[model samples]
Target: MEEISILLLFDVLVGLTLVWLAWQTLSSLDLFRAIVLFIAFGLLMALAWVRLNAPDVALAEATIGAGLTGALFLSALAQLSASTKRKDEENKIENS
Candidate 1:
C-alpha cells in the first residue's frame, strides 16, 4: 500500500508538471524561452511514458521530441537573431 501511494504521488506530480510546462510554453512572450519550455515538456512527457511502462516510446520521445526538436529550434532562433542584427546594422548605415 505504501509503494502504491508513492507511485500515485509521483504520477500526480508529473501530471501537474506537464500541465505547468504546457502553460509556460504557450504563454511565454519570448520565443526562445517558449522553445526551451517546449523542450522541457517533451522531456517530461518521456518520463511520464517511462512511468507508464512504455520505455521504448519514452526513448524515442527523448531523442526525437526533445533532443532533435530542441536543437532545431535553437538553431533557427540563432539564425533569426543574426539576421535581425544584420538588418538593424544595415538600417543604421543607411540612416547615417
Candidate 2:
C-alpha cells in the first residue's frame, strides 16, 4: 500500500513535469530553447515509461521519439540558420 502510494505520487510529479515542458515548448519565443525543452520532455517520458514497467515503450521513446526526432529538429534548425546566413551574405554582396 505504501509503495503504491509512492508510485502514484511519482506518477503525478512526472505528469506535471511533462505538462510544464509542453507548455514551455509551445509558448517560448525562441525556437532553439523550445526544441531543447521538447527533447528533455521526451527523456522524461521515457523514464516514466520505464517506471511503469513498459520496457518496450521506454526503448522506443528513447530511440525514436527522443533521439531521432530531436536530431531531425536540430537538423532542420541548422538548415534554417544556414539559409538565413546565405541570404544575408547575398544581400551584402549585392549592396557592395
For model 1, the stretches where C-alpha displacement exceeds 4 angstroms are: none
RMSD of 1: 0.9
Candidate with top TM-score is 1
Worst 10 residues of 1 by lDDT: 31-40
> Per-residue alpha-carbon lDDT of model 2 for 1-96, expressed as tens digits?
999999899999999999999999999999899889989999999999998899999999989988899999999999999999999999999999
lDDT of 1 by residue, 1-96 (tens): 999999999999999999999999999999999999999999999999999999999999999999999999999999999999999999999999
User: What are the lDDT scores of the predictions, listed in order?
Assistant: 0.98, 0.94
lDDT (Cα, 0-100) at 11 in candidate 1: 98
Task: For candidate 1, give the lDDT of residue 52.
Answer: 94
TM-scores of all candidate predictions against the true structure? 0.94, 0.87
- Best candidate, lDDT-wise? 1
